[model samples]
Target: MGGGEPGLGSAEVVQQPEQADAGSPAAGRLGLEPLPYVVGEDGAKQPVPGALSIFLRSGTAAAMCLDSLAAAQPGAPPFLRIPKEKLLADIQLQGAISDFHPIKDAIRAADCDALAVRPNLDDAYGDGNNYEVACSRAAAEAWQAVEEWRRAAAAEAEAAASAAAAQAALPKSKRRRAPQPWVDQGTEAEMEAVAGPPPRPPALLVLERPLRDLVASRQRHQRAQQQQQQPPQDQGKPASTQPQQQQQQQQQQQQQRAPRLVDVDASDLWSSAQSECRPFKDPNYDTRRARREAGAQAVPRLAEKGVQV
Candidate 1:
């Protein structure tokens, strides 16, 4: 037909479909042994296994079998084939899966046919066998417990406060009384009661002038006698000598009696006198004074007699 295409036109491609071997290891492990086909409600032939069919019939049985399988093979995917009726019964008996509302709602939503509808006609008519009633009862019990705890705590707090106030209010000692004013009235009355009538104050005795002059004269005579008994100093001294000295001493005493100025050198006079009267070099100088004076007097006599002076 076309130029130089004789062999190309004669060569036709042959095709063959690839088939999986039933004796392969994957097939044997997966138990993919040509599942018994069944016609579904839609009139389609679907693969159905005996084990899967049994699991669908009994949820508890399916769960047990899956648990055993998972234990045997650690890396196996989880199997979920619980029957609707068993799951609903479990949900009713066990209550909500968790306290979270959203999780319960999601579970209800996902398993609507099993969980959303009432268990029986009585529950649907609101005969009080629902999850809400159980949750409400639990809440009421919790609130009651809370109120009891609060009341107990308040009572305890009040008791403690009252005890503290009582302790604070108690007097420290038994001798509690108001302070009394200091007065002699109480003391005077008490003394008068114990000692009978009060004693009279002594009368002022007015002495006559003559008796008063007589008492003065007796005092003067007694002072004169005292002066006579005292030893007298020499009176034979010249008036210019001893009398002047006495007058000078009297004047000096009178000057000393005058009020002292604050900035006086009284301490300097005492210190200077102390320095002048230094103790003798010989400690026994006072004891040896008699012998020394006697020896000196004898020396004068000996010198008069032409002995070695």
Candidate 2:
């Protein structure tokens, strides 16, 4: 009778139904799925493999790629809806929405034309495959960046280790330690001692109090007397012209203070060339010609006749 009623059923029957497979979409959609598991050696259920265990493995790389793509997108309340047609197309594609890890040359054949366009958050939030496609492109870029960084870090570490090994293989005499510049470790007191007590601060000289007071009083008295004497003369003159008169007086005083240039008779310049100036003589005409003539006269010419014995 309970089963016959329109919707009513036995409480036991309502409560219990054949459970769906844990990994199946139906189970996930209905919230009936247990946490993912695998059978262990003992036939006991074990938790599914972690990201780190599966990330590098070729077998699980596509799954990891999908997971990253999903994670890159906003989670569903308004569910992430990919159209059935687009889903079928993605399945037909070689690498689907995203290329798998250590992406092979074969995977490049898959039409990833969507990746060519920059991913936009607005498009990702729109209806249909836009969300998945944008997320896949973005996640792929992020994965590539991480992979490149990992490789670079690994290479640097390997190079450093090899360098260290090579250095260790060298003989002690051949090995050079990295140079360290000298750093001052002297304490303030030690430094002061080395510098000989800062030149005794030049022995500050303090003026006696009585002398300071006397000097200050004299200055004040002089200022008072000057001020008293200056006003009567100032009353006779216009205030504006006083500055001009003062400037003129200063100019005149400056002229008077200038050093005088005294005029005197200067002696004629003493020069060897001027003192020895006489009528110019040509040595060739005077000494050389005379010597040549005398030498010519002194030399006897040989006659046509034979010389006397």
Candidate 3:
């Protein structure tokens, strides 16, 4: 390269005297060759002072420009460092004193616009796709909670229906509840009824028992009234009854004279009746029951004079 004009893709290089000797090659060289550098996380090697650099007017002049920027924005880093693996990773950095606009304007004024290339923000954080995924996850969780509530409600309804069905399946006698009288009905009228109408009979026997007892009692009353109204007749035998009485007395004496027993055995009757009557014997009888006791050994015949018992 010539002395007055700079070489393409070369920065001002500070040479070491030990790197060159007088007789060897590159002995009188004075120009700068761009060094290899990686810039802005592109993962590709670039020439120093190239388009990817932050200050590329001239390495000699770039130092002066950096000093001016540091004085203007003292909170910024003193040096510009290019990342090697990811683009615009600095998107997460806070409170940056020097953003791209001022740096770009400064590079343009210095006639070195190639240095201030702006990186894309979309590429910095994966185009905001991670944010979309988080929103989708939140929406899915809400829908899942709603679905769970619906299922629980449905299960409760089904259980209630099953319980109702089981109750209905029981026998009517067990499951039936007592009837509630209507409020609008005549409660006072029913209470005041001295003889309420009979309930509808489910069967005839429910009505028949009281009817039979009433008929029997009425007949007995009529018979008692008739007996009370009639006067007792004289005790002297009537002419028509005298002969019948004589004949009946004569026949009874004849039967007594030759009484023929059929099913009556005195010995068997005595033993069986004594055993059966044993329970009726009072323990206190020997001491105190003699006066009050009826004649147990001698049974008084219950037949009236002319009637069989």
Candidate 4:
């Protein structure tokens, strides 16, 4: 016979025993006495030999045993020991060959070297009998992918949480208070009273021209007083009190005409000389100069101008 249909090979078919004469050795081995044989299906007297008889029993038993074994192996194809009777009944009633194919393929694909059957079934089939061996492999790979994704996501979340916790744990630095507007409005001496002594004044305020000039003038006066005590080298005539008094009056008049000093604190001055002062220009300078040269005593002078000084 040509190698029967793809799955129904010669090796798979159960062999029947031959009918023989009574008392023959084959009949004795079979534990049956072969008499006159009728070939028709209804009237046939079939004699099965011992080897074939054993094979048939073992084959049917194998199918039943597979079901129990398949249960033990979770990843196995789901069609191990499906009841042949039920399979036949389903085929007869439903005539669904597509359902039968997957079950058969699952069983055939199972590794014979495996220690136990693997009864992995597809979710598409409500009954475990419709097993999909390939689908089980695919599902396992998909599950692994899902597990890897979950692990990565969990690690990322842990790292993010740790970073947040670290940030929370750090001590916060104290913020400096903003400088008050009133603090900017005063002299160094006044601000010193408010702020208390240690820092001194800002450099700009401490080095102002007016305060610096006062310091220099005090030093010059001290030097002059020290020089006066030294003896003169040449003999000189004694000055007359009458001329000295007249000269003293002239000096007083000059002193009275000099510009009066206005007090400006260190805080109001700029740091550099260029920034501190600009040359003054009088708007009425030509007229004032002409009037003064003409010996005019009263030239209708402008009123005093008030400045921040």
Candidate 5:
């Protein structure tokens, strides 16, 4: 084939020969991966090499074709092991080949089912491809659950901090406790054994005198006083008998009464001189000689005027 551009009806335009410099691992695994073939105006298959670049840009049509070919031809080349149903979904979504009327005529002519195509994920983003790999449903759901749990944990921590702040804002209690006196274990045990304080003595027992003895002494004194204050009473009598009775009564009264102290008058001048009372002195006291003989003067009488004897 010449370097000149191929006619629109040639199948060789979409066929690719492998190139090590292309840097596609999938292409390296097999020969070169071809683009989709276009249809000519005469209902002939015409390969368009530009279809591969288009599939790489918009969707996974190249990967779908490679995977389907690998399934159909097990001995062919390396491709991703995607499920058959996923492959059909890729084929159905990728291009709707019927939209390209020329391609639709060519596919219908070959009796091909466009709905049965599948794609390999590796071929889409593997090697030099910069596309992000897609995750499965279960994996995505698990990541979402992890994110939710993390948020819940953060919320719980925030709630705990807020509750602590609120608790700290409350007023402290003002109640104070009475100081307890310290006691040794031995002393406390003894106190408990005794139960309470000792019993008190009775009031009667506490008195200095007996109750009966006090009452008897009080009654006797009252009777003696009453007898002394009263006057004597008598029946009618003769004069002599009355006089004798009166004399006897007088004698009895005189005997009962105590003698009164009387002082005799020493003013007769003939009476003998009475001795003066001596002053009392302490036996243990020592007196000075000058003070002991004080006031000891002799009495003197003057001589008579007519005779001096």
Candidate 6:
């Protein structure tokens, strides 16, 4: 018999007693009634056919009873009874008539030995029909599965708790702050203006030229250039006296030495070198505006080509 079909056998139908014993295993203990047939058209009941029918029904009953017991509800009656008659019938139907080996095999397959009803469980001397069953193999196995599931759930919960505790115990400085709704978000340009422009890169100094010679040469060139560029304010006036010329020369030397002492000469050299070395003006000085104009021009071309702009 297949394990899924909940039907009766075709050989012979066993007749149930007119009056069943109130505490007998023939009556369900798990508040369940045996479903031996299915409802068909016109409200007629049709008998399900197969030896597997009773086996499946008995297995289902065993499962339900175990589930109730596991719930451990307060003030609930203990589950100690099982349907033995159905299990026995299933075993007999599936077992071979001759050798007792088939019956043993069927009993093992149906798990009937563990699930069958026993009358004397609470009291060995008591009538078997009025007490809990002796062996509950199916229930034991079901409870084991439930226990495993509970252990897994408990482990997961413990891991989560540990993680939360670790996070809570972290220092305030190390903890991440959530975004504040009251904080104002300004435009990128405004934010950049507030932060100020980034510092410019340091000037590159060439080491090939001797420092003394480079400085002296540059100073002389600057002095000569300044003299040529200066307007002749006293072209018709007499030349300066020897003492005055000497004093003027001393003042110019002092001005040059003062800048070198304060370390301003290097910056001066950097500025002058950069301006003299690079003279070309950039064509796309306003890059963002240029990009906008290019995009605007492309729109007309795309429209002329029958493409969406």
**Minimal lDDT window, size 10, model 3:** 127-136
Q: List the residue pairs that clash in candidate 3.
A: 41-83
Choose 1 or 6, whichever is better by lDDT. Answer: 6
Cα lDDT tens digits, model 4, 186-219, are 5656855885444543332222235565565556
Each candidate: what lDDT? 0.35, 0.37, 0.35, 0.36, 0.38, 0.40
Which residues of candidate 2, in runs, are more than 4 Å off?
1-139, 179-189, 198-309
Residue 299's lDDT in candidate 3: 42
lDDT of 6 by residue, 109-204 (tens): 554434432212232222221222223354334334434544444465576577667778999777655333343356555955886544664454
Q: Report the C-alpha lDDT of model 2 over 32-130, residue by residue, as the tens digit.
A: 422222334544432222100111222233432333443344431211223333433444564533322222222333334333112222332122122
Using TM-score as the measure, name the better of candidate 2 and candidate 3: 2
Look at candidate 1 and give me any clashing residue pairs: none
Residue lDDT tens for model 3, 96-169: 32232223322233332122222111222232210000012222233344335444444655765786688799
lDDT of 6 at 225: 58
In the predicted model 6, the residue pairs found to clash are 7-48, 7-50, 7-53, 8-48, 8-50, 119-128
Rank by TM-score, highest first.
Answer: 6, 2, 4, 1, 5, 3
Q: After superposition, how far is residue 190 of candidate 2 from its true place, in Å?
A: 3.3
Residue 84, candidate 6: C-alpha displacement in angstroms: 5.9
- Compared with the true structure, model 1 gives a TM-score of 0.18
lDDT, candidate 1, 1-309, per-residue tens: 001111111222211112224543333343232211233454443222111111111243344244443243434322323334544455466564312222233333342232211011122213232111111222223334433544444465576567667766877774334334454547657855796543664444543345555455556555545644766454777766887767866775675576643322233235554675543355432231122212111122233222221
* Clash counts for all predictions: 0, 0, 1, 6, 3, 6
lDDT score of residue 211 within candidate 6: 61
